[model samples]
Target: MPAGLTVALVAGEASGDQLGAGLVRELRRQVPGVRCVGIAGPAMQAAGCEPWWEADELAVMGLFEIVRDLPRLLRLRRALIARLLAARPAVFIGIDAPDFNLGVEKTLRAAGITTVHYVSPSVWAWREGRIRTIRKAVDRMLCVLPFEEAFYARHGVDARFVGHPLADELAPGGDAAAARRELALPPEGPVLAILPGSRRGEIERMGAPYAETIAWLAARLPTLACVLPVARPALLAPLQAALSAAGVDASRCRLVEGQARSALVAADAALVTSGTASLESALLGCPLVVAYRASALSLALVRGLRLIRIRHFALPNLLTPTPVVPEFLQAEVTAARLGPALERLLTDPAARATQQEEFGKLHALLRCDASRRAAEAVAALLPGYRAPNEP
Candidate 1:
């Protein structure tokens, strides 16, 4: 490998930031002095990535939101593409921003620059036609889920299942007692972790319902203590307002900024907005009920268009052979339904045991030293790149 090989990376959101950071660390370990540059969040920047743009610029979610920001996003993409074309990095990795990165990747790959898409778009689950666009966009598709690699291989796309970084970060079993100690919670009492969602949009849709669920749980279980883990500080005010409006006692709720994993580990059960948090709870061995509510138009459009191919949306159910946790969506996401589901997980020993047992298997399947594998896969695309232990 060259002495100063420049590797460009673009991560769209917080999760991608984390994945990018891990990949950066592993790449640095294997190939010293590798220059990493592109759109990054704090984590990626902390791991020596030169941030050309803040990741939050491309962090917009939902079809409507993206449409609203389309012009700005397009301009950002054009600027990024021009810069990359001029710099001509050895490899360009797009981390989870398919809408933005795939276009950039396609253009760069056409220019003879090797491109890798770190997280495969959910083409396998929905919008299977995207496979065609992905084929042209990336030289390699690095998938976190096992099923994704199979889907790509069947379609003849060059792909590898590098496993999920979260699985490697969180083990099958967690020390609930230790987590409680860290959170300064009573070790013996019932605690619920409420994760409405990370995005402002998610909080807007889910905060009230989640708070209501918490209030319902508190009413049922007198000793119930709640922990709300806010991904961003901005989410805290809205969450608190929702909880207060729901008549939930603020004194009984501990609103903590960040430390989401710790809250998951410490809780007896969690009421989480369906997305990555469901997977995190499962990985942490925390049984949870997943709930999601989007804008009425968004849900209607998704249902009207038949966009979702899969029956299940939660990560745990998607990964598992069968549903291991309950999922409430749209109108079904009421506290009357979610509260009972969470209550069952918290109170029923059999349910908790079954979930933990399945979580162990899920963990084993995904704990494949993901960061190292991702780095190795990226390195293989570079000229003169050799494995660290190769002679």
Candidate 2:
């Protein structure tokens, strides 16, 4: 390992952890001898990152959650900035998980460390003011989506679109047969997969309707097997309670913890609560009903920032908005409505074919080996680069 160049990276959530790991692999490939350190999860650590703290500690979501964790987040950011200033890493790469990464980038950039923000903040969606913050922090921006490049250019930020890795993985067509085999279930049966959400607040808000939707589907199609791939097991009891209150059997509902990808792969038609799962469902080539519900207060807070012009929230629909799948949001996120949407796709071959076609187009756009491109951008900023295979 070389002493002249060290890169400190911080990724706050599971998604960021994934992005960070890929970037580390790419960066290592470019500069095999460069020292890579700081807060990272399993993927980045596996890519040879030396972790200074648990990155999960910074994975808090939503407005109130941020406020609650503000002091700790600030303290962590200051500690990272101080260490970077003291040792002076040549470049600081802040992966997704904006709130945790942005301030660190700002402080480090002010202190003369080259800064790169690996993922653009949702400046295109809710916060227009973020452009100023991004400009103050990042020296270069690496964006996964194609649309983001234009946005960064408009704001005068150095940004590049390196293509999306999910696109590469899913472009080859989704494996429905393999998914069914892994679950040990017959493809003949009606399979309704429940993806509440990754965040606890989201799971709490969307979990009841999700379980209720499963119960309704199970009753309508008795042969239907419900698979709920839960994110936080702490909320599982409450979710099961919702199913019981609706007269749905807890035993019948197979709760598989940490099997989100498997659940998306196996389902005939998934009832996915909005967010990352929507994209995963599309990539898996599963026709899905997108349902999302937020507390009235949470809803009110989000409504305050109305910069979003996109008609579709689900990634599949957003990619090709020809009503490929039903998007039931807020009050429209009912079990009755979602159940039929899933049923329609499951029973109708024509409908599923149309969806599969659109999903194919979306997958093509996202399918680059994202980590490699991302790593190249980060490594290009480092000095004295060496390929990992080189002596």
Query: Which candidate number maximizes TM-score?
Result: 1
Q: What are the clash counts of all predictions, listed in order? A: 0, 3
- Expressed as tens digits, the lDDT of each residue in 1-391 for candidate 1 is 6778999999988999999999999998888889999999999999999999999898888867688899999999999999999999999999998989999999999999999999899897777788899999999999999998878889989999999999999875578889888887778879999888888989999998888888888889999988888989988899889999999998889999898999998998888888888999999999988888888777778878888898898999988877889999898988899988988987898999888888989999999999999999999888898886888
Candidate 1: where are CA atoms >4 Å away? Answer: 389-391
TM-score of 1: 0.97
Per-residue lDDT of candidate 2, residues 1-391 (tens digit): 3455788988887878877887887776667577789899988899889998877878787766577788888888888778778988988988888877888889888988899998777788666888999999999999877789998998899998987766655533547568667766566777777888877777767877777777777767878776788777787776777777778886567877777777777777788877777888888787788877766765677787665556677766756747677898888887888878877876777877888888878787777788888877777677665545658
TM-score versus the correct structure, for each prediction: 0.97, 0.92
Estimate every model's Cα lDDT from 0 to 1: 0.90, 0.78
lDDT of 2: 0.78
In model 2, the runs with Cα more than 4 Å from the true position are: 1-4, 171-175, 305-307, 321-323, 384-391
Q: Residue 244 CA error for candidate 1 (Å)?
A: 1.3
Error of 2 at 260 (Å): 1.7
How many residue pairs of model 1 clash at the backbone? 0
